[model samples]
Target: MNFSQLQCFVALAETGSFTEAAYAVDLTQSAVSHALAALESELGVTLLERNRKGVVAISNAGQKIIPHVRALLASEAAIEQEARAARGLNVGKLRLGSIESIVSPALLAGVLTSFRTAYPDIEVVLFEGAMHEVGEWIEQSIIDIGFVVLPARGVESTLITTDEMNVLVPYGHRLYDRAAVTLDELYEEGFIMEKTQCMFRLMKRFGFELNKDKPSIRYQASDSATILAMVREGLGITLVPRTMLPKKLEGVVALPLDPPQPLKIGLAVKAQQTALRGTTLFVQTALSWAHEHALLQTVSS
Candidate 1:
């Protein structure tokens, strides 16, 4: 009838003695007898034959149901195994979103590597897009988690890192020697802009109202590589995250902005959705990675 009753019946049938069955099941002899009695009462059938020599035989019903009871115990064990695996972060699908910049294989490589090493059974799905697109995906429940620039509307976030926007000018540009330049100083220069909402917001934060007195937009593209290439060709200077640039600067020079416009980046998830086990593990792994790499920073929610 119940798991304990089934266990007691099986133990009693196998051992043929109440004392041994109780010892096998870690219950008192009286308790084991009570369980078998309850099981037989629920099924309206005798499960065992008691005698002066003890349970010398099992009833026909007990013989018939032994296999089924074993199967039920096996199923219960499997359920427990699956529950343990889920709690251990050994199984589940993690749907993660991120902007194109952070999705680069080289970026966050250590974090991804460590996470995969710790939880090899967890499947990780990465969706790459612009900041606004990633934010929309998280808000709509299309993904479990995402990495985006701070101030991601409609989601809770944990700060990962902060980087400042830098000016990328051609190698021989006149302002290349300057340690820093302001938005106004580059107002008249040919501006190669990356067509993303985050970039536009950063521009506005730096006092360059893109809608109002727009800079000379000589080139525009959604891809950072394309925008950087345009700058390399001397089409115009551009602004980009310092971390996004390559180590070897051949045709371009990156300079800090005089009044730096800082970009805060963090991992975000839907505010109301209960986070999955995989998602929680991933967030913890990312935060640990950020702390180890000195990328951790405090940011407003």
Candidate 2:
């Protein structure tokens, strides 16, 4: 089948809806349907089930061929990349993903500057989400690379930096001036937490069985800044990565946990695909910049 037909098949298989697949491939719904129909007709097999309810399901034969199709697409992309490289053309598009907490404006700017300096013709697209979402994007091939916290599953990673977790308390709180605070001590206070998988993983790592003894969770927020604001307003105490806070604390105090919980940050990519040329160069540049600037001590996985 032609690449366009394969592309249509892949998009439809992944999205499971004609409209969404068309949007993904930047084609009209009619075009996408026509391409898929042509592919199925050529193969003499039903690849997708059609229904009046707008439901799309891959047939058993389609399921068996998905991996092969993905591999063919990847090989085609690699060939195109090599051809451009041989012609000395710095042309490529890289899709990157990162968690909001780790992607500060300064850091993001530095990365973009470095990448652009090396490959002016290349275009970079960025997507921001929570750590878990970033990982999901990588696994689904939605992004070429992602910045994720350590212990990421279903992908290979290269360590970029590491930061410690700190207990955040209100300025006038009893534990504000303490040298260090224990998890048990913090458990007694009201808690405001970000609704992130990393937070849950951190708790599990520290042997805090949330189901057995749930902390007094007063508020659940999606952003670290909002959680910090809630803590400053005397809503509750929370734990956050040290890198997430600013240098100066106004109405809050961040104390080192009695037993440090180090957060390891890394760049992750799909386990199945080797790094593309653009992706490899970008990762190297980012690592070098982080090392030269002493941004969050570099670490190894």
Candidate 3:
């Protein structure tokens, strides 16, 4: 019935948890419960149903109301969006950061161009760094937002893309012509670990040790370019996210792993940056561009 009630209702419906909804909307669980109860009472129907299995979902009657409720919320958001868009033209600045791998294939330039078209006055400053550096910047409030691999720390995120992990081998390597590479075959080769931490990150996703055998580490570098160069020279092979591979595969071939490991990427910001005008616009623009280009798919809600 009121703004807070609407917000709480949407949060509860989406999260399906009193505790999670409370945390999401920044309210006490009791407050969330009270607000939902009041709204249901006013509407003369129970929206959320619960049972003995500790289950919760939208009630039959609630399903009918949800569409209208969502429309109301969407209209309200449009009103606010218009105001923000107008003010965005007057003055704004956003500091953006990203792990280097996501830059080119993400078509980040399209996002930037769209954002600039939408808010010509807003200035976007970009910082490229390793995964840890980006996380550190977000935590320190050094950058307003960034593209981070999900299950990330220190920031809230909305998933934007998932790039598959691939094994990069030199042109004439024995496995170069293979469709896929197995973990055993991969670990046997000398690894040129890059600073991106792709192995450990994907390891966490798969819940396993990627380099369990202490595979020979022929080289390590902070940049993917250096690692790729080493790979080209037959020094060692490395795991590279598909998004990071060069358009022309002259030096290395990117082969999918037998059981594909996915790299989930998201547009992330410090919790406080969510309310920034420039940051909000950039996020919106990036998502819109990705969706239009068929460059995005959600890994999780």
Best by lDDT: 2
- For candidate 3, the 10 contiguous residues with the lowest summed lDDT are 292-301
Clashes of 2: 0
Instruction: Arrange candidates, best TM-score first.
Output: 2, 1, 3
Model 3, range 8-38, lDDT digits (tens) per residue?
8777776778888899779998999899899
TM-score of each: 0.66, 0.80, 0.63
TM-score of model number 1:
0.66
Pairs of colliding residues, candidate 2:
none
Which window of 10 residues has the lowest lDDT sum in candidate 2? 292-301
Best-performing candidate as measured by TM-score: 2
**In angstroms, what RMSD does candidate 1 have relative to the true structure?**
19.2
Residue 54 of model 1 has an lDDT of 74
Name the runs in model 2 displaced over 4 angstroms: 12-24, 40-68, 102-105, 151-154, 271-273, 295-301
